[model samples]
Target: MAKERALRRAAREAEAAKQRARRARIVARRQRRRALLTRLMPRRRRTGRLLVRRSRGQRAGIAVVTLVLLALVWFLVDDIALRLVLTLLGLLCLPALVVVALGRRTS
Candidate 1:
């Protein structure tokens, strides 16, 4: 009975160690995937930089669209002073749009 107990304890210990090793491997794989993703994924550019990267097509499209939409909205409102208020609106929208584009999806 003593010998059997010892043998069973040793087997349990070995299985525990195997489980720990498997968990460690899984953690390592996840870390590697995160590292790879960060390297490959496009990150948001910090504000206040002289040069920033943007999708030219998207940038142009946004600008043109914003201008057209704002102009239409402005015309509908028909306030001359309001037109001056939106002088830098397009520039402001660029950074905001960039932030949204780079935002992560929340579960």
Candidate 2:
């Protein structure tokens, strides 16, 4: 019984070691692939000014689209209840917008 228990414990240890080695090999292979990819692909350097300008343009486009959509909705909708719901939705979005603006400022 003692020998049987010892043999079983050894087998379990061996299996665990094998699993650890397999995991190590997988991690090493992934690291090698990542390095190879980085070597093969060139990274582009973007200027801060360009990024800021592009973001501003995007913000302006979004504002214009939102205004146009809101105008259309206002003209098409006759129910005051729907308009009130829309207004409530807009108000709910305001806090989220404020949080995003604050988060961006910190970054």
Candidate 3:
């Protein structure tokens, strides 16, 4: 019975080692693929200026609110030119508006 138990334990350990090796190979393959893709892709130059620092939640909330407001303007407004003008002005003033709304950081 003891000899049988020993063999079973050895088998389990061997299987675990095999699984670990398999996972390592998978990780290495993923890393290689990522590296190759990154090399192939052209690097994007960040030409835009930093507007404001906001948390992810804040950014998401702003996006949702902006979408809702745009939708309202699209449905409610009669003139297409007026809607386009409003959208352009809103986008241009967004950074300043956010900074004003958020106020200065204490820390």
1-107 in candidate 2: lDDT tens per residue? Answer: 99999999999999999999999999999999999999999986666564353367656765675677567667888998997777677656854764465345422
Better of 1 and 2 by lDDT: 1
User: Rank order by TM-score, top first?
Assistant: 3, 2, 1
lDDT of 3 at 95: 76
**Model 3: worst 10 consecutive residues (lDDT sum):** 46-55
Whole-model alpha-carbon lDDT for candidate 3: 0.85
RMSD of each: 11.3, 10.3, 12.6
lDDT of 1 by residue, 1-107 (tens): 99999999999999999999999999999999999999999996567644335555766866787778777767776667766667466556766776687553332
Model 3, span 1-107: residue lDDT tens: 99999999999999999999999999999999999999999997664645345666788888988888888888999999999998888888887887798765642
Q: Number of the top candidate by lDDT?
A: 3
TM-score for candidate 2: 0.46
TM-score of 1: 0.43
Which segments of candidate 1 are over 4 A away from where they belong? 48-107
